[model samples]
Target: MAKNELHIALVGNPNSGKTSLFNALTGLNQKVGNFPGVTVDKKTGSIRLEENFDAELIDLPGTYSLYPRRADEWVAYKVLMGADADIKPDMVLLVADASNLKRNLLFCSQIIDLKIPVVMALTMTDIAAKKDIQIDINGLEAELGIPVVTVNPRKNKGLTELKKVLAQASRMNQNLHARDFMNTKKLAPESVEGVQKLFPQLSEYAAIHYLINHENFPLSDLDQKAVEQVETVNKFNPNKTQAEEILQRYTRIRQIMQQHVVEHGPLEKKMFTEKLDNILLHRTWGYVILLAVLFLLFQSIFWLAQFPMDGIEWLFTKAGGWLSTTLPQAWWSDLIVNGLVAGLSGILVFVPQIMILFGLITVLEDTGYMARISFLSDKLMRKAGLNGKSVMPMISGFACAVPAIMSARNIENKKERLLTILVTPLMSCSARLPVYTILISLVIDDKYYFGFLSVQGLVMMALYFLGTFMALIVSYVMKFFIKIKEKSFFILELPIYRAPRWKNVGITMVEKAKIFVFDAGKVIIMISLLLWFLSSHGPGNRIEKVEQKYALLAQQHPAQADSLQKPLSAEKLQNSYAGILGKAIEPVIEPLGYDWKIGIALITSFAAREVFVGTMATLYSVEETDDNSSLRQKMDAATHEDGSKVYTLPAALSLMVFYVLAMQCMSTLAVVKRETRSWKWPVFQFIYMTGLAYAMSWLTYVIFS
Candidate 1:
């Protein structure tokens, strides 16, 4: 709002490296927020525009024209029109890719029509140079009557020149020179339907937008004055309308580009990108590579994340032990040490694993490899009645289902986006990681199988594949009833690879870790406390009775009591609050080979999958164990009345199968509601996934029993 820090807005098309440039200039001085009434995230920062001048830089969303097609598109168009808010920019900084000048220039032309004080930031000169595509920057600037500065935004090469040009534009505070700046002069009377006929120049882009009735365009706050003037012209000019006139403006800009821009790109395609895309975008091999990459990604998270996960788990268990013993022995001690401290530590322990996985994903996304995954998966998805744009959202489901479901905005087709939203949660998310990790450890051992693979790794891999396969099958069934034409063409830009930006990757990992720790932590901690209360205190004074009975027996036959302490300890647990709950849930979970304790775990874990590890650790640590025995060994020796071990291989397999299929994450469900803009889809998704998990677990138990 203050010109003391002169506002300079950066505008560009998608993949124009506008964000990278912003990062190069401002670093961490940047702050991200939303434009007033717009969901599009806005990034602004302070950059030295030129010597002795500090400029406030605003980076607008990537868009093709002032004719806004989507929410992201509208934000860019509105910021320039000065309709967004009171913070009108002093200078408009337009960044366009020099390699794609003709396509990029059309957008600049639209901005010119808006009559803003403009300066152009030319980008991607490196790629242009590599391909031997030459352009005279001064020549183009003189022809367009604007100052142009060549920049390699990633390398921070163009900041000095760009800064100088901004200072010059600031100095040229001359009267508005744009002839088109005088707002619309009103069109001749024409019928609403005949308006299109009056504006022949706009026929190309408008006809396409009109046919789809693109809903992404935010028209809620449209200018009434512009609307009335357009309506008057449309009434008489039956042959043309306001929309057409706008399209004609773009056409005139296209003609200008055709005359000045050379057609070298088509003739000599960037051999490097062309050659790489040929294999990466290949019909058959492309899909294989995509699948291979995803499999590797999932596998890497499982294997690489395990060390930190194990170390963190050990730390929490030891800390809980220390707290419980160090405190004075009383109800306050148990609640504070076991309930409060353990509960908080439980959720924070998994931050390490989440950080590791998120770190890997950030690298994949920024390197342009993730887009390729969407490109390869789009074809098979459409056959199953979804769009290629749906692939990114679906893959994101693996991280957390809620945001993945929300990312469906990129999908052009309403039905396809909805269908994608409906089934994405069925794909395994990282929340399921804790469940799969523990169960696989129980059934398959940590060691490699047949000398080449970790047995536990193989099991983890299977669970991920299982979730993915089920998602495709369900989507196929949904397609039979939800009719779609599958007519939209995907415009995917395969960006050239750049070295991984560690700072960007680190920032992403830290942000994601904090979000998951706090967002999911609250639910988990509450569940842990409630569960702690439930297991600690039971009805009819059963726990007091156990203490009384044990003390009396211990005095009468001290040696006998010593030998039977564990079984008596089991009775204490059975009589406690957690024990009764376990019994209550035991009947329902009985068919799955789970005891009342395991039943308690199954119920609490729905808050989050990783909570299972903490819950189990808390329960096991309550009973005393020999100093030499590890938690796993103590668990392996746990027995029923029949002297059979509770955690048999078959039972572990059943639990694994259950967690692999269950829709257990509550935060994921909440996210789904926000993303879909209704409860119908998330409710359906939750029910289907839970039912699927139950049936699969039941079948596994029945077969083993």
Candidate 2:
């Protein structure tokens, strides 16, 4: 808390355009990290308020009311109530959806009553106008005793006025003298007084929360004991008090709305969103449309990305060739050209696909179709022992499983949440996209059906469908073993359909690409360098012996040297340390149509699934070649000891199947451990996923071979 700095908390209901506002105000200044001691994301950004005064805007998680239900809601509640030590706001900037004024006002009133300097930014006014509802901003401001400004953050409208109001509100000392939205003292007088005595800094409304959620607060042991004693002595009924408070707040809210708002009677013609939902939410057509959407999405990944991918691969290939020829032939030069460039080229070539996939998903989310996906899948999810809420995390898993697993905390039912966490990794993430793309390219042709649909794209879609199908099957079976049962229900609010924000979509694509390149790139480079060292040098004098033998043979038979070079290099690599390590586990993976080289990939890729491609690049680069070939070219031309093709259709498909099911990521396992609060679940996850991968891969090879 700097003397001249202001800490403003941004609070809002879920999907109330709060995030848009945060992005509008902060732009690229925002950074996301977990809150102290919690896995929940804490978004904070610096905003220039005045010449000498700056403000730190904290975006707390969205919750409906002060009565917190989920972990994220508790986070917001804790921050607003001053229970969070790390973040204490000097003023609160509450974003309220103008269209849903009645419901939004409930939370707004709660904040106003907390005696915090508050400013309300009204959003979705256009939607409200479309619905024949209008709000008088100044009137509402006067009623709530706070500054209310109309803002459209998506268009960056009214932001200057909102900031002006916020600055003015911060300079005022009118918060303590503001009108109470609801009289908390009458609801539970004794408990309120008891809590206020324990902590004098809390307002009457905040004291009520302390009485209700004391255990969840960051209270000292003695203070906790005192609060518990107050509860025991006063016989506080939290549920009753909460119900009463809500009723009183709404009663006051209705009076305020009647004075400051106007709405027309229901129209004979339905709203646009409602009309669209009629088809999109249909029982049969909805599922058909979903499949069609997904089919087009995957098809577009290959159709749109192939040219850029080819160009990238060509650039890397040329760079490697130039470096290999221009630089003096040395071990370091080989490491640079063969090891580093090759490994990077493997992962960087698939950037277009990753960007397209995330961009499309973000489009779905922004357009409000993502929620419909949850609603549509609720029935099937229930059959699989999960509810509609699990769909969000499972879909999120397609991007990365770490955050996806963390999001399972939103599911209230312990069994369903646990089941969702356990099975979510089966969703083929973007990390697996490179592996799937390369393998499908190797085995499946690029021929198009009906002049539009791609065969390779169909195979890619099949892999995703396979993973999702298996996740459901696994959840269904595992439901019976884990015996915890709690009743669950799905109540979803589908936001109005809107055009996708292209700017936001672009930002997401760039950010995701950066994460893939930088975060995953680090691991890939480290493994590549280590793989280079191991494959270049061997145990004992085996590598030297092989080299010496090749030199003598080449000298004795000068004309045949060119023909013998491939075998000489091959023999040398076979005796290298990497080859020895790969050969050690070759027998186990052999049944799945994998050789020692693929075995090496499997071992290294446990660090991350995307590392599989980098591992391949490194291994192939270490094998001396005459031409500067891309990783795909190297893999396509690879052969076994008997000259049999290594990446046959059956082998490539088997490898894809293995990655689709295997728990190959250490980070995912670690996140599961943290979420489940035990190592047992992650251990079990590793065993089951690995066993499933092995058994299924073996079957895939046997059936297809």
Candidate 3:
């Protein structure tokens, strides 16, 4: 290792401001990937410390303690015990919440006893002050015998001094506790001594952990046998030893707090957060507010993103026209003007909605209301055979299912986690926004019911809720089939409410929008090109024959040339390869009120739901060669051979309902496969969701037609 470079691990309890500190220190210099053999998120970043010294910071998952109740906590334990060589840290940066010192210190003290070089970074001191609490940092540092620094990462405070302290701490020798906090030898002398005989370098705390979880710990066959033998000979009682050790640690922590901390008010001060939570978490009123918040979110997705979406469409339309008139009309020119420009336009127009949605979600998180939402939904989650933690992943599925599925790793119960992963894709992600918006505009009226509420936005909200409702139903059904019998519970911390951090919110919005465009954009453009080729050519001379027929018709009647051109081109599309495939599937989907063109879009959009619009855009651009209208306009004016409208209200609604229930995105399936480590679940997921989509869509069409 370089002298200036070191590896540091960040560990703390949930809602301890650990992630905020990491974000402040790393800013946009971070990368997220999975651990070596696990699906848990591993966040690493580069940090520039004092005097040209740099460090690699790994942000471990926020865990309550080192007892390893969750998979993520086990990752932390493995690294802290120097068992995971790939991620073992040179030093540990333990973050403690000053407002809740007693609970936070329990985990901090455990880290200190691990005998690793460690520094304590105290956070939320300002919040503590609001509660009339004060901490003597110097006194606490002397008591703990480690370097301590105060930092408010949200405000970018104390970071310089923190780096300097870390640099100085790194120069010192390895941290070995000269005085033990709890004399484990007195509590379990034989057990500790027997374990230490095998690994003589084990710290007091490390030895105790081995006593509790030696079976799960990293050890070779021979080493494990020796440890088991020691445990057997020593008559180790893990439950009694763990309880005794924890009580002793808490006793010392209480003494330390009395000496180094001060409280200036009564315990129940009716703080600001409590006052706000009263209204936000009220039994009846809380549900009302949550509904209102969701309504506003969907309303804003349409109200705020409309102008930009229109502007993007107009710009692309003009660009396509310009390119067509300026360049010679050739195959490549057509590809550039029609295929690529049309696809790019379809993708870019949705960026505004994505940015707005993610920005508002980030605000919700920063203000600490997101946790309350999770808390309030725990009842409903339990009813669906999941715990409160599943709510976050389900809500996240509205953005994307890939990460939402990955987020389920924290759920300790195997059955609940698998159920969460299976049904999460049923939530309407942002990719489906374009499809719903276009279809709603095509059939639904824009007039408000009560003069202020948008009828269109209401339909959009209905589509989202429809997805969520079906997810819960599917999960309830799957619960009985997945036989893992572990119990489920929810333990969430509601952090103190604070003003929204606009900087963090802005960064999140930008990053999320970038991922949507670049990641989904790659799949969209490639599918668009493939659809273009498939729709442009047929299996034989049929495509050329159709074109010739159209040319001859236009030649004979020059006055009716413009009127005949669109139908002639539509005829050619019906004979193209894409048209043949769509026609082949048309019989299966006809009961759902879809025609061949809509069928084509459905087939192409399986790569990504958002590609539905691009497929429609390319197909329309091909059929109506002289028409330079926006996608919605073309879709709105579509008519059948007998002059009846193709996209009637019934058909439009059926399409929306189908999309709500369908599992069309291939990326989601890939993620499910990766997470479950089997092809069985993803296959079952696709069949169930698609079956439900088809059945519901058929029923909807039957009722409305």
Candidate 4:
């Protein structure tokens, strides 16, 4: 690659606006994936420099210092240490928050000691100014011997200057003065020199890091032994060296800050964040406020999505009706109208609800209240054998368990992180919404509880609570069995509250909706097509026999043929391949108030929970000739062989409770395998959740029956 076609590593602390800056620089030119052999998200984007040169920017995970305490932080450390060959950067773009420069400088100084070329992009300058603080950029640059560009990525400021600085810094033949920031040679000269002799290319700081993290770094056995010998000869204690080095670095940082920065405001005055936290983080009222927020979120998801959902359903119903009459009455027509159309409608109708839930979550995250939630839920989380950070993933689990399980990488303790991943799927993701909605509408009355609150809304809230309460109970039980020796701790940074960036929130909503539609929709559509075929054809000519019998009846009673058509179609369905499988499982699920029709839906819907609605739609469409009726309408009119109602209150409620606890999604299992890196956990997770769902559902059925 040319010098101008450089690779820049974007590194920073958590919540330091590093991601915002990256979005500004890259715009829509970015892709997210996992790093090689790890589940940590590796984000890369491209930007044009001066209309001719292009740069690839890698956004590494956020961290506090060179020493890593977690999996993600270790990625950042490895990349900066040149231990990662796949992502060696020509230059580092260190993003720092001006408002918290003192803490941010700790990581910045550590990066500078790595001997790589770096340009500082200082963000949050406006916030610092609002607090009556002033930073002399020229003085800090001269002191640190690097270029510093103050920027507000949210406002799209200083980006041009940032690119120009990056271009100049990348082309420098002579390296930047890395030791001018902090000299580790002064802390442990003998150990550093001894390790440097072995590596030959390592800087003094790199040599020191190698000594401290030799176990973690990628090194040959011979080189590792040599490093260990040096450590033994020098009597180098890793902990003591780290503490002394941090103290010395801070002493130097204070002198630099005093000379180059100024604060005009009183340091002891309470800021707006503290004042808001006084109430938002109150001991008694904090939990109440959190509950209120969750109630509003769930209420808005249901209320705001109702109209769009109705519109989508109406549109699909009209389309299906038109296809039924307009298309030639053939098997392919049935596939398109009853299979593809029905399945697509089933997935699309839930997009509005998914978008709303994710959009609200993005806003909560942007305003930094998400962190406060972690803080508030810390005590409760610990009682469930997790720390505060586990709450964020659990909350995110409400959106989807796949990413929620991935988000547990931040939890340092092995036991707590594993527990969080195991219980997160029980939080009732949006995939279950369609199942809940169709079942609730079928059985529950939609009346007002206090002349204000909708009964349906209260039930929705109760279902969420049921999932969460079960998750907590499960975690508390698993805590004693999954033994680990590592201690758990929670350290959270509460960001200053600000107006949410609408653009980011909008992007998040659109992205999440797309993932749901495209990723999950593919599996649902394929299964729906296969299901149509399986339900349309059967072995041993049973379908032909049913058709012949119906034909003879039509000739004998022409007037009653119209009524006989439905039963004729039902007879053919019962003999079809799909119906045979449902009948095979009927004995197991019969006590749950389910017939073979509902049994077919339960079997096919193992692909996804939302597919339950589509399965019902297709099955009913195959049996009934009416094309204009909605899914709920068709299901409501369904009956048993004895002409008794199939979907009673007990059955509907039992189904809802079953879905709340069921691990029916194959995609979730795939993700668990990827995150946990073993089929053991996913298999174990499936059996346990399935068994739990069956027991609970049976209990619900018996009580209501």
Best candidate according to TM-score: 4
Residue 639, candidate 1: alpha-carbon lDDT = 79
Tens digit of lDDT per residue, candidate 2, span 196-299?
98889888988888888889987789999999999999999999999999888888888988888998777546889999999999999999998798668767
Q: In terms of TM-score, how similar is model 4 to the real structure?
A: 0.90
Q: lDDT value for candidate 4? A: 0.84
Model 4 Cα lDDT, one tens digit per residue, 503-576: 77776677667766776677667766777788799999899999999999999999999878767776787899
lDDT of each: 0.69, 0.83, 0.83, 0.84
Where model 2 places Cα greater than 4 Å from the true spot, the runs are 1-4, 173-177, 326-331, 392-418, 429-463, 481-487, 559-565, 593-597, 604-656, 665-683, 700-705
Note the residue pairs that clash in candidate 2: none
Tell me which of candidates 2 and 3 scores higher on TM-score. 3
lDDT of 4 at 133: 79
Candidate 3, residues 161-201: lDDT per residue as tens digits? 99888888877875534566556677788878888888999
After superposition on all CA atoms, what RMSD does each candidate show versus the true structure?
Answer: 5.7, 4.0, 3.8, 3.4
At residue 531, candidate 1 shows an lDDT of 66
Give residue 236's lDDT in candidate 3 (0 to 100): 83
Compared with the true structure, model 1 gives a TM-score of 0.79
Error of 4 at 364 (Å): 1.4
Which stretches of candidate 4 lie above 4 Å from their native place? 1-4, 264-268, 307-349, 396-412, 437-460, 514-526, 529-533, 547-565, 617-649
